[model samples]
Each structure stands twice: as structure tokens, then as C-alpha cells.
Target: MKVSALGNEIAGPGGPGPGVRLVVVIEDEAIVLAGYQMLFESWGYVVIAAQSADEALGMLEAGSMPPGFILADFRLRDGQTGTEAIERVRQAFGPDIPGVVVTGDTTVTVDRLRLAASEGMPILHKPVNGRQLQELLTRSFKT
Candidate 1:
């Protein structure tokens, strides 16, 4: 799965790599969000950070820049699950937008996997590597 196939313009700040035009990251952990944002921005992807599902939804509803990819934490603040947030985003943005769930919860069951599969979304375990995140975003854009 090449990142280019996902409709991302491979133009980073330095005009290097496949430039991802926009990406939304929904995570409760500020530190984690900062890390992801920094990495993606360094690679030239326009990154949008949200501390909660509600904030992310607000951004989308406000017609803030559309994102080519979405990365969410399975657990969130205000008792909202990542799956719920993803559902809302999918409904609002349509299924063409790719989504990925990155979580520390290894207890995800078969039913959860099935649900994610049904939505054509992938779930990645936490402590995600930079390469893995890149790969997930690339694959998502392609799908």
C-alpha cells in the first residue's frame, strides 16, 4: 500500500515524501497527541489535533479543513469510546475517509475486530511505531 495511492499529495514542507494534505488525530493524551502531531507535521502532513471526540466532531461540523486520514484512540475523555467517535466521523465525512484506531487495549475481542472490519477500519495496538503509523495512514488513504 503506497501512500500515493491514497490520494495524498506527497509534498511535505521540504517537498519530500508523499505530502499528506490533511490528517486528524483524536486522542485524550496531550503528550501523545503532541508527539503524533509533531511527527506528521515534520513529514509535511497538515495535522489537526483534538483532545476529545466532541472537539473533533466540532471541527468537522465547522467545515474545518477536510482530512485525508484519521487516527483515534480507542478510549477517550467524557466516557466516549473511539469507536463511537469514529462512527460519528464516518457518518459526517462519509466512508471514503480512512480511519484507524490506535489503543493500548489488547483485550479487543473478535466482535470488536469484526465491527472494525465491517467498517473497513483497522485497529493498531498502542506504543505505535512511526513507520507503523505512516503505513496505517498510507493504507487507509488507499482503501
Candidate 2:
């Protein structure tokens, strides 16, 4: 699906501007992806959707426009996990692109959290509140 079809508002009068903030969301669940797209778009940010780690990686490989931030689901449909996907993205795009892993699983261990934290990546519990998502995005892009 076209990224704009997910309800994103292009930044410029006719299209998104060079300064527009872009956020890549890797989610296997259609509903969840739509929800995240809507939320980020409502905040005036452009959203890119990918259904799997491989798909997301392909975009990066093809030199797709870099996103200001990335939000990914912890458990993807494929065997690949969000952490693995984010690591790949970071390796390709560098550590400057901020990322957040969203998950419904509550059993994420402290060590995992520490690893993500060490990389300057944060974890957000699933069923993310729109307000919280917006706030996090704002902070992420501002840096």
C-alpha cells in the first residue's frame, strides 16, 4: 500500500517537504500498522509501513528515504523479531536514527531492556496511547 494511503498528510502544499519528519513502522498486524500510521500522521509526521523485517530491510537496501524515527512491534509475523530488525536498520542507517520497540509481551527481561537502552533505543508497551506515542515521537525527532 502507498504510504500516504495510510492517512499521512504530506507536509508541503502538494507533497511532503524535505523537512518533513518521516517515521518507519514495522508491524505485521494490519490493524496495528494502521493504528500507528494514523497516530503518527495525526501528529503531522509522515509514516512508512512495512509488514516484516525483510521488507523493511529491502527498503533500506534500496536507499529509501531515511526516517527520523522507527517504531516496530516486538513480535513480527516472520521468525524475525523487532530487535533483530532494528539492529539491521541501525547497522545500515547508523545509530543516529532513533528506534522504539512496541510489544504486548510483558515478560521482556531486564537484560534485553538494558541492551536496547545501551543502544539509545527505548521500549514501549503495546496498546500505546496516542498521546504517549505523539510525545515520544516529538522527543525523538527533536533530537
Candidate 3:
């Protein structure tokens, strides 16, 4: 088991002994968030999950290390988008932090495309297949 900077033990059933990668997941749905947490941990990633961007930021301990990746639902509560949430976390950490936005919304507007492009983030359509997500994460963290 690995203890986090916040003193929380990090481990999951059938998971690797200690998580080497850290991921921040911003999802509004409780079930989805739980699933992501379980899935990420099982993949040997430590997950920080929250319903909103603000909540995720609040949960982080000061001076904690930056997450290796970020996954966020495009349409969040309180009129916030995944890109915005990613930017918020990046602002706290570093702008080079990579993130992906997952959305159920089929309609993609020009503004949305522009924002994601400008931020160097990719948008994935839901429901994201586990293998696809795993591939994406593996490819992303490999860089």
C-alpha cells in the first residue's frame, strides 16, 4: 500500500502494490465516478475523484504533486465544462498537464472544438469503452 501526501492509504483489490500514476477524475454522476475510481486503481493509477472541478481542487492537499492525467465529463454541474475544469487544475498545477474530455453530447460546436484544440485536449464520446480508455491513458502517459 502507498500512502498519499495527504496520509491516505492508496490500494485496490487485485491492483498493483503501489500506484505509480496519479489521475484526477471529474464526474458528476456518483456511479460513474465510483467506477472510474475503481477502474483507474485497478490499472495501477491513483485516482482523485470529485463531482465538480472546485471539489476536486479542494480535495487536493497543498503542495501535493501534480497528477499525471486528468479525465473529466464535458458537461459538469454549475455550468462548467470539462475544458474549464482542466484549465482550473492546470492553473493550480502546470499548463502542460494533459487532460481528456468525455461527453455524451453528440453535438459539437465550433467554440468547443476551438477551446479543446487550443488547450491540447481531446474529446471522447461516451460511453468510452474500457479498452479504448486504457489505450488512450497508456498512450498519453507514455509521452
Scored by TM-score, the top model is 3
What lDDT tens digits, residue by residue, belong to model 2 across residues 44-129?
Answer: 87776788766666554443456688888888874777777787777777768888888898888889878877877788886787
**RMSD in order of candidates:** 7.9, 3.8, 5.2
- Number of the top lDDT candidate: 3
Model 2 RMSD, rounded to 1 decimal:
3.8
Model 3: per-residue lDDT, tens digit, 37-119? 88988998877787888877765543256777999999898889999999999998888888989988878697897789778
What's the TM-score of each model vs. the native?
Answer: 0.76, 0.81, 0.82
- Model 3's number of clashes is 0
Model 2 has an lDDT value of 0.74
Error of 2 at 1 (Å): 9.8
Candidate 2, clashing residue pairs? 11-16
Flag regions of model 1 displaced more than 4 Å. Answer: 1-20
**Runs in model 2 lying further than 4 Å from the true structure:** 1-16, 60-64
Candidates 2 and 3 compared by TM-score, better number: 3
Local distance difference test, each candidate: 0.71, 0.74, 0.79
Pull out the clashing pairs in model 3.
none
Sorting all predicted structures by lDDT, with the top scorer first, yields 3, 2, 1
